[model samples]
Target: MTTPRRAPRRAPAALLGGATALALALAGCSTPSSGGSAAGDGTVTITVGDRPSADQAAARAIYDRRVQEFQKANPGIRIEPSETVWDVQTFQANVAGGTLPDVLKVPFTEIQALIARKQVADITDQLKEVGLADRLNPQTVKIVQGRDGRTYGVPVLPYAIGLFYNRALFEKAGLDPAKPPRTWAEVRAAAKAVAEKTGQAGYAQMATENTGGWMLTAQSYSMGGSIESEDGAKATFDDAAMRNALTLLKGMRWEDDSMGTNFLYNMNDIAKDFAAGKIGMFLSVPSAAYQAVVINFDMPKKDVGLTAVPTGPGNDNKVLSGGSVEIVNPKASEAEKSAALKWIAFFDLGKYINQEAAVADAKASAQDGGAVGIPRLSPISPEGFERYKEWIAEYVNVPLENFTGYTDNLATVQLKTEPVKSAQEVYAVLDTVLQKVLTDKGADVDALLREAVATVDTKLARAPR
Candidate 1:
């Protein structure tokens, strides 16, 4: 596999304009209505909305299958599933207008916004009564709780970022395919060696536009850095820990030359290149393992491996978790809300549904003789774990359990609610700071960071709540 050296072409201007217009039109479609009756009898129809994903098509099939099972068990109950675009503002607009589905799938970050607008129901007691509260990951549960300590939703699945490596490249560089780097130093060293020996980019980090800052945030958190204070009311981008993280990334571009010269190669391109055997290693969600494993029907399977994101000098182990939560609308009737909760619980505990989905995801990768990561829940099945272990043993040398870390709940929550009208401005300042450090050589890291921090602080202060 080789990295696609050419930059991705931009979307046509007319297409871009049309997309903007469509988004605006959808936004305009949201308009509030007078309060309606809240009665949920057997005839009540429950509407649910969720954003589409690559796996969602299959997940939806599984969900519908379960719905059929549920309906068979309880006659007269109907579940209607709707698809929505993945945009917070548009979703909020629907919520404000009372046009939202009775139950909606939302990113954990958006829960705060929903809470602030009184758009979602408080499920704290419901969860306790159902005995599902104790089953959730505590870190995930924290993200769904309101400031007042009431639970609002349940997470169906959780995803964390990690390192995706190409075994062929590692072997070519005389590095052990079984042993991946654990610290930032090892990552740089191994990547540099691979780049030099293989004559291909060793690693690629997302440094283009707003994503550059997002990648930096992940790296910073892994180094025990925080972008804001504990309460999220204060900025801390200028702190030594963050500066150190930035310094290390800048060093990668300048000293090691392991990263691509251009920063536009995001997670998608990185996965594609790794699958094509063009790139050595990169940061990506665990799901990338599935993509790589399924890249080509005839491709040999000894190409990909998965491990936790490399550790930093201070032993900080963390990764950004991205997934959606299922929230019931406040306007939903008691019976509708109860039905929604039951559906959520059903999906969460549907071991057959989950296991089948996991197997399908893994088999998709296995077609290329590549491996995929198992969901935390799927490990509960003895047969599932045995199959997962066999698939993983084909490529990865290190134990997957050794690389896991605490998800950054604080950062996830802050980014969700942080007032920032200009995502571009915030990203630009941080990118400039990093570029200067990497290109100019020992370029007053402190001053660069302070300027970036000030810019972000101002933007944060002015963003709409």
Candidate 2:
């Protein structure tokens, strides 16, 4: 059955144009007063930012329910929640205006930039107070912890890259729906079969700039390649493992004819198309499963499947963990800080809120016959697991066996050392070189690698310790 498409929401041209004006106007403003303790009466406001998602409604419902519960538990504390669209530029403005939320959520990838600017608050002590320093998913902790050995945020949820497949297409192609690919060779073979037999695009690997080389990172890491060395001082894109990874992606796009030529489709578009069954299988985050189920609502449950990311030759099975961490603003008042930390602690320790959110996400996906894959945390109790398991079993069928193991070892694994000068510049050069290699097969890979290495080395030399 074909899913009905919703009309795309378009931003007002005037509003888009006025962003700079708004930013300038807010630039000089003092930071918002973190709601001080009302001697146990003041409200604590948490401003959260997120990418809009189909599962967001359910997630928000879960948030509201939990907040209400928390309010009841602490009658003197009022929780004010505000949602903002995830945009770095706008978030920076909010930061400048001192209107930044006391506790805010941001993408894991962007946290480095925020840390560089000293915009995010460090909450190592708060974490210790909440006894969450060790409780948090180690992989999640790694993403938010700076080179200074100080952690800046508390992770609410964690996500990992994985293969999402259309079961109907798999069956039609005479492939086993239950056994998804576990390695790159298997994936390639399966995609070829699906495309040749089913006459549909086998995969939708992202090759676009708008995604900012994220898909490349996924593919590269799947091959056990590091984007930057362990110290984060240099680009490793020219390394042997990375070359192989990039070559595989390039082969898919240029030789295999599995991917579309236009790389402009952002990750969301890719997920939407996959949900519509236009594509057979694709690499995506666990959260995309929720989106495919609710937003597209086209593909039936019997047709969807989820699996851990496929491995490559010379690569161990590893999936990059991606998600945000909640950070309390440093400038917030003691009361506000206390309240924010309290909320973070609640999220970490409160059984009801975390389980409810996961269950809601799972149910939403199940509504469309898709499986909900909660990253990092599994349901601790039978009741909590059952709440979502019924939907998962009925629609999106996947084993709930421990996938967190794959991320746990890597989560606390530092990819780079902190205070790396020219970190951004090194990344930029590396991305540019990798793009050239991926899109232009005829390009000299060795030359590009050498150039990237030189550029990174120069930056490292110039960076202050």
Candidate 3:
């Protein structure tokens, strides 16, 4: 069934223009006090970010209703909602100028830096007081914890990078739609078969800008390689895992000729083409790519298939993961912090424990024509997630069977976050290395990797301590 598209759950960064936002933040214009004010009558007022814009009527309606409900439940707390979202260009400016909301949503990648810079509040005590600490998924919550083991944010929606394939294309190529490739060897064979049979790009890799590096890191992790060391002190991609991954891609491009002629695919380009049935399989976040394909490009819902990242020589269950975190302002007053955490727990995390919330959110999303119950790595424990699924089963709109390859394998998956130090710089360097290997048949993988290592090491060295 064709469904109308809804605004992404985590609003895109484009809601506020970058340059304009940076200027406004730096100028302290429209800046709310970092520490929310307390009224004489004991009302704790906290401003929250990511309030859906009016254009997204359904989402905004749900958000507004939730705000009203939260306020009604907690009579001593009041919410002042804002449309401000996390934009890379404005994030630093906002932090420096103290223009941030008491509660805001940020990506997992930024949590480490925010923690190091003391720009986010430590909520270890708060989480415990609310009895949320023990209920959280230990692995998923690690992304928002500091080296000191203090929790700084609440993980909302965690997801692992997976392989997105076209079931229709698989059928056309005489491959099993239910059993996607689980190993590199199988991927190569499947790509060859799909290419030979359907004359389309059997498999494609993103090779443009940061996405090139992002996918390269994901591929390396799937093969048991890491891009940076644990402490972020050194580059670690110059190992056997990385070499093996590149070698496989080189062979696919040069020998199997399964990859399409295009070697400059970004996230959008790859998703567009994949939806058009020009490509068979590629790596991406299933839900994100699903929206691009089924919503924006009008691909049939039954045609999309999402599965875990195929294992390789490393044979480990490791895969890359990223998600959004709801963090309290570092400068928020104790009262504000308490209020903000309560709101986050109610508005963002109540679904895992509250059946009413789980069903309400699912029904609202489904009514808005949003994909509900797409497979994902949950922020809550396995038991909690299962219960949540059961609670919302009646409202789920996405085809559950199409996601079994991902959902059924969650027990064995180990999620790793993006590189912590100089992540963007590291991605930029790897982007060059990935593009060189994909576009040039004679490219020397070792030499390219060595150069990338040197560049990333330099970046890591110059990074803030």
Instruction: At residue 329, give the lDDT of candidate 2.
Output: 71
Q: Judged by TM-score, which candidate is best?
A: 3
**Tens digit of lDDT per residue, candidate 1, span 1-465?**
001111221212222222222223223221122223322442446776762445755555544555565554434446676675435567668867868887776664456666766778987766665446665656566667778988888766545556767778889999987777767788889889998999877877655555566556666766766666544344676876677787777677778887755456554555566676677777755443434433432223456555656667554446555456778888776556666665565544333223333333334444433333432322123343445445344434223442333122222322222111344455566667766765676688888887888877887676545
Residue runs of model 2 more than 4 Å from their true location after superposition: 1-72, 78-100, 112-122, 128-135, 146-150, 229-233, 253-264, 293-297, 314-317, 332-335, 345-443, 447-465
In model 1, what is the error at residue 422, expressed in angstroms?
Answer: 8.1
Ordering by TM-score? 3, 1, 2
Task: Tell how far residue 60 is off in model 2, in angstroms.
Answer: 9.6
The lDDT per prediction is: 0.57, 0.57, 0.79
TM-scores for candidates 1 onward, in order? 0.71, 0.66, 0.86
lDDT of 3 by residue, 1-465 (tens): 000111255322211122122222223111122344877666788899999899988767667766776766676787999998887567778878988988988877778888988989998987876667887888788788899989999988677888988899899999999999888789899898899999999999987757778888888888888988887889999998899989999999999999988999988889999989999999988777887888778888899898889888785648898878899999888778877877777766776667665665676667666677878788888888889899889978777788788888886678888887777788888888888888898999999999889989998998765
Better of 2 and 3 by TM-score: 3
TM-score of 2: 0.66
